[model samples]
Target: MTNFSHRRVKTGSDPRRLADYAALRNELAKLSHPARPDVNWQSVEKRCDALFEQNGVELQSAAWYTLARTHLAGLSGLNEGLSLLETLITHQWDALWPQPVAVRMEILCSLSQRMQQLLRTFSPSDSDYSALNLAEQQLTRLISALQRRELTPLSPLNALLSLIHHSAVRLEKSNSAAAPVVENDPEVVLTSTGISAAPSPETTRSANEVKWIYLVPPEPQLATNPQIPPPAAATLWQPFALGMLAMLVLGSVALWSWSLFQRPDPLQTPLASSLSALPSVLSPMQLETLRQQGPLSDALFTATQQQLTRLSQLPPDWATDYSRQLVKQAQLLWPEKSRQLTQQWQQQVNAAALPADTMNGWHQGMTELQTLADKLNALDEKRGRYLTVSELKSAVFSMMTHFRQTIPVEEQLRLIRQLPDDSPARQQQIEQAGQHLRAQAYALMKEKEKETTAASF
Candidate 1:
């Protein structure tokens, strides 16, 4: 029932725009509420499908959609909700490797919250208990990974961990009470060493009644005479049978010993061959070289870029050495303009006053930068120093476009006007910085076009 007019979709198919994202969120919200009898879940699911199918879905929006769907599915009493959450966690865990610590932290916290909510809804006897237990363990492992990576745990993360711990305790208690009894004792006796007594009169009478019925058991019997012995041939066969039995026992032992001594066939010994074929560990130098090579395949590039984007969000001192290595790789890949582009990015990041509302846009900008870096690296691998000028221009244009979208001119001007009179000169300096970046981007595009023209000739 929420108004959709204010949530207008931006031009093009980008799902990150507030309007489209808000609409999806509103739909999911309505669908997730179990008490809303008027809501049509089927239509909402179709809408979710459509939204996900849209091009260039932003990470936050994608994450939100996935989570909302998970909740909606749970509300519908479908086990698939837990399955979906588990899949998301697995994918996100792998993706965390290339993400910045802050982003990773955020992702982990969000996943933890989802898991906590799902687990809270499950009874200990439900079929989903095993999955819940696994999720709880995974959350622990994730927290440990964060610690190992030295990412400081946020308040919400700590609270989520506490909630998970409490849920685990409740689950454990319920499971223990539900456990099957392993043994049964039928009789319990009381013993007193100081006193002994004869059986009661009733017990004696009952015992006599049981004995009296069998007291007449001795009955009359008939007798028969003795019989004659077997023939001499039967006696002779007994000795022969003993001799045959001895021979059979000796033969069986001999066969058993022979079989024991036999060697196994070489071709059938698959385990031995498999063990021999196992690869040896790489040397430290080799490992270092592999690390320096960076990501080669598209999947690797995507994962690496995601992680680098997250890393870029953290304080520079946190990942100083790793950042330097990545920068070196970027410089190598885009020898002409990586430094300049990075400087412009830093200026924009520095000038922007990012409130909570604009964080999505900021993250989108970072993702675009990562995409551009990945494209450059790919191009370098394919063409070496003789890059595709058109491709480079396109990548640069895409990055700038995303950056501009993230921090629009109107927002920038508004932020500038908010600056205090004491820092009047700072506003002008920042504005000039923005102008310089725009000029640089224009010049870069022109240069790439010129390069393309020359290459064609």
Candidate 2:
């Protein structure tokens, strides 16, 4: 634990004051990580704002940085986070508040990553262009900043920027491919290879086994009645009967195989059908011939992506009908998952047709509680014991207030009200926070007293 109290700032540019600045930065980093049920971003954002205004040169930037990130991670206020970071990097940061160049560089890199996601989810239409432009502009700014730093082409940040740039390029290429400029038609038409593509060894073996079963007649038993000498007419008729039987069997197998191909796909059936009426639309043999596929979520994403890619290529009027049919075909094994996924796809399609930004301006802007909590825990903790006892006290109180305020009052009551009265850890933390606050508080009081005593003498 750090002695986070009683710090003086900018007093003759002292070494200790500099250290306090370092410590304050670390504390802010910890408090702003994405939330658990224990962590609430909106509440923490308020705390950082309060500290940002009151802190000295060294600590102000840290508070600003953390608060910006908190907004980015919160479910609401995605714009607020993006705008703040934009301002932070757009200006010469050191001139504004002595924020280190390295810190600004780090912010720039992180911003580029978020922008890359926007490019990935961009719809292949004009409605998507404005948001993509925002992302592209920011990414361009980041690249410019790195260039200003004279970052090498091989630097890690450069590598990340390259990946981001590629997403945008890929999206643009896809749209271009969809609207080909070529005047000439292709000489060769690409028809479905169908099941005409060569079958696997297993499929070939199964087919051969079935064919041979009918084709090969059982061997004749050695005639115990050979002495009777079978009639010539009976032997001749026996060969003809056997040949006819084999022909009948072969015709029946051929009919069944033809019917299999002609069967209507369940995906093409009307929407009123129950998912559970059949164990699967595929037959036991067909299912057996094919290997099993996917965890439902992975399958849904894959299927949806492929369909959406084609859907995007169509004109909006055509896409409207196509999207409905495409989602129907994408129904997976589970009805519930299928329903939820297709509904979401429909919503996106509807939103895309309008000028509205459907994804809250980006694909992943919303942060759920559990996800936020996990992010909070996984973040790198800043390390260092700095800040004089008084400043440390102010800093500690800010952190304490952060811990105190983020949980809802009802949750707070439930968590603490019925717990054992003896909370050693809680008591110790309070004592520590109070120690920081009071020590700094007394320092000012004592300083005032010294002036009075001097005047009286």
Candidate 3:
């Protein structure tokens, strides 16, 4: 495939261009060690796009490469970055990048490494086999091209070959595996069709009952007709019992007649109270403060951003209003930074044209973030207070429910990425956690959908 950058003939050899490239590279490097990849990646992406529009072929290629790496760096995931990387370098690196062969080798090596990292992030069951195959094809092509250049098998080339072999083996193993992997869900489960509860044992068991062995004596069950057998005890109560039975029959008939005319009340659904629903907005400083609290805070931040990003399909007016509301609230909280943020945001809004999705999910996401903050605050308040076991259990269960509701798969992957890069254990953990979250979310959503459908009737 032809390199898109080769269509332009602009030489980016000027001193100023080189300086800009240096700055751009500096930005790209940050993604590799990003403290706030969610927040920072967008800006880097925008900058690269702008540079690509205004710069020469070499610079544009460089920009495209950087943009691709941003995805590799967690802007998206492996497929996107891999697609971009493959598109950029097919047969035009010399025209696209216009650098030394050594630099070319380095860039390709980095791409291979990133692909390796991305591959490691998936399990056999949930892996993107298509992506692996694509990467394998691309690696083969690149390695062959390098060979045609009469280049010896260097470390980078070897790495590419290694990944290709790994992909083949993986694909083979996946195809040859006879046993289907069933999701282990214990009692309540995500089945092939949907969520379901496993049946109790009693219905399927034999008629013979098993005796219970108890250290403490079990409570004896009462005989239903104990008083009827003892004539002395029964005789005096019989008249009273007959009177009571007559009264009960009359009351039951009257109640049944009343019920025939009464209507059943509709169930009231609980309102989902979120922080975004609050009267106030969170400032950037406050968001930073959230990040400072610890990993859960970081996860909360990450998860909120993710859910908020999904809300990006909102109406432009709604998005604008939501963002401005945030700006106004931040102004109330921190006048200094809010002014700058407001100006920047407005400029962006205007540039994109008003009534467009300007800040999708900011408001709703803030509410979710705020909801988490409130919950954490409540928990914090309990410090030094003696919490009963029941109270502790309720709190734990509530927090877990909120966590699962708030935190998405992305945050877990992000957290995993934050660990040291050289551990097989970390890779396995990421794959497990990611798959579990996805399956759990899918099951719950499907179950909720069924509930909604049933409730409508």
Number of the top-ranking candidate, with TM-score as the measure: 3
Residue-level error in angstroms, candidate 1, position 377: 98
Off by over 4 Å in 3: 1-23, 31-39, 56-94, 124-127, 164-168, 175-457
lDDT of 1 by residue, 268-346 (tens): 4763553355346679999799889975578866887897798689542332333344456557768887888667655
Worst 10 residues of 2 by lDDT: 208-217
Ranking by TM-score: 3, 1, 2
For candidate 3, the lDDT comes to: 0.51
TM-score each candidate: 0.27, 0.24, 0.29
Task: Write one digit per residue (lDDT tens) for candidate 3, span 1-457.
Answer: 1112212112233223555456666765665774834335445544544444456334334434434543433322333333333334443445555467766666666656654564455454323344445445544655666677766435765675586568657766867764443322212223233222221221121233121110111245687877555446646788899999999999999999899877454431221231235345679999799779865647767878987896686542454455656777778778987888889976755444312232233444556567656766787778764547786576556555555544454776787888888888788876566444444443455579899999999
Evaluate residue 337 in candidate 1 and report its C-alpha lDDT on the 0 to 100 scale.
75
Alpha-carbon shift of residue 117 in model 1 (angstroms): 5.9
lDDT of 2 by residue, 98-120 (tens): 34656545544543444345334
- Model 1: lDDT equals 0.49
lDDT of 2: 0.43
Q: Rank the candidates by lDDT, best first.
A: 3, 1, 2
Q: Which is superior by lDDT, 2 or 3? A: 3
Give one clash count per candidate, in the order shown: 5, 15, 3
